[model samples]
Target: MAATSSLFSLSFAPSRRRSIPLSRSANPSSAPSDLSSKPQLIELEFLGPKAGGDGSSPVDRVTAISGEKLLRNIMLENKIELYAAYGKVMNCGGRGSCGTCIVEIIDGKELLNERTNTELRYLKKKPESWRLACQTIVGNKENSGKVVVQRMPQWKK
Candidate 1:
């Protein structure tokens, strides 16, 4: 007798059967028509060589980090010293309104969260690419959204 192929795969849970629209963004925060004028959804990939010590800093090598991971790492790496403050201060760990984790995306502008009044206040007057990291977390699904991050402007250095 020949083995039969089941119509449904029982290996994965039924609840996990959710599908993501490839050409469109399921996240309202990352929508394209957002007031910010920045592309709200895209897949960002690591562009260049690995980041390491050859007297090279994080910015020296081209490393791609998801919007969420980037925010967490920045807060952790800087010991929470970098971000600015928001109303009453925040402790919920980046639910996207504190405006503390504002950052600029140097490349791959498509992947990001919508801009808000809080974020606008924090980002200094500059060219495009500015965004709030805490608000821009990307999912881990294949070819999920992403945004490229770079160090703060040179003057802030």
Candidate 2:
């Protein structure tokens, strides 16, 4: 019985993901085993200083750290929680879907995940600086996409 259980465990256990070298040397966009490029917990103030949020005035640009806790930061800052839109209307919840929880990529685009057909469709409709929250999962394991998100005024829930 123990041997059988051991075998079952071995088979069922999740396999570690392997990282492969980038085929195109021009832009070696490799998916590393570790998210080393991600930040640790970037804070993106929604309203900005003028609105009494934080940071310099003229708030409007999005912010993020490569490995930061995105959702926690948003919650801590009292910003709108878009996680609620995941799966139902947005899907991926934070996996990056529905495009409902979209945010402008005010700064870091290189650090984000490559866009999908679904995301591209929405992005094409809007300005180039936008991306879906659920689909933008890049960055640290703790954070969905290591990005600080604020609900777009145009998005309906």
Candidate 3:
């Protein structure tokens, strides 16, 4: 019983605490001013359906920071419609598993990352301009440019 009590006391003993200092920049002016360190603005132009069947506007232009973010996230953040009615209910939530988030790159394809293996498998028969927004990254964190995107129509899918 004494040994058990000692073991219980040892287990309940207070643990040692270590203080960690918060890291902060010594001089804000000394920070690197290189272009790579700055956030690049990526202008996005979203073209809705031509016939306006989905009740969305024809064109929407927005800006995002170039930081290797997914195109789907940028579109969603900017309130741009990226999915159709059916796709809204049956999407993979940016996992690249479902190809419902397809967008046509009207221009500035160079600003996007290369197609992933999932995109290649899913869009093998599709046009080269068609990209899965879930699998598409807008910029490489250093490039600043304008990208024109057209939302894929429901009938096109």
Candidate 4:
């Protein structure tokens, strides 16, 4: 008991600590500006039930701030419901684990980054159009165009 007490009483600290320097950001906000001369916009078409299981429209189009990341812009930061199942913790949290965040790339494939290994593995069983919303970045090298996307196609409601 005395040895245990002594161990608890001992002060443990790092021998030397290194202070990391912080880099200055061009923008005050957390979001960085796209390289395009004009602000890039991600155009999303939220596909609803075509046969009308719910009152939602067959397709709902929305234009939002030009965020380069798809999951961060749409799922995390915005109210746009890209999937029937949504999660930050329960799902992969944009790491491309859970396939719940899959969306169909109707157009603007060039606008996105590339298919992550996670998406490529998970989507092997699915169609080529299917992509994990979290893995898909909105803008690409040439950011002058709009990134068009269609929400999950299997969404009945």
The best candidate by lDDT is 3
Better of 1 and 3 by TM-score: 3
The TM-score values for the models, in the order shown, are: 0.38, 0.41, 0.75, 0.60
Model 3 deviation from native, Cα RMSD in Å: 5.7
lDDT of 2 by residue, 1-157 (tens): 9999998877765442224444443354543523345435444544221223444334433455555444334433555444443424534444443555666565545555666677787678776666666555445534433243344534422
lDDT of 4 by residue, 1-157 (tens): 9987776655332212324433434445633543334555767666543545555556656665454556445654656666564443366556667777877777777767778898989899888877888787776534645555566666644
TM-score (C-alpha, index-matched) for candidate 1: 0.38
**What's the true lDDT of residue 143 in model 4?**
62
Q: The CA-based lDDT of model 2 is what?
A: 0.50
User: What overall lDDT goes with each candidate model?
Assistant: 0.47, 0.50, 0.84, 0.63
Give the candidates in order of lDDT, highest first: 3, 4, 2, 1
Q: How close is candidate 4 to the true structure, as a TM-score?
A: 0.60
lDDT by residue (117-140, candidate 1, tens digit) is 656676657555766666554432
- Mind giving the per-residue lDDT tens digits that candidate 3 earns over 5-104? 9988776664322244433344465445542366888899988856466766488998888866899998898788898888999999999988999999
Best by TM-score: 3
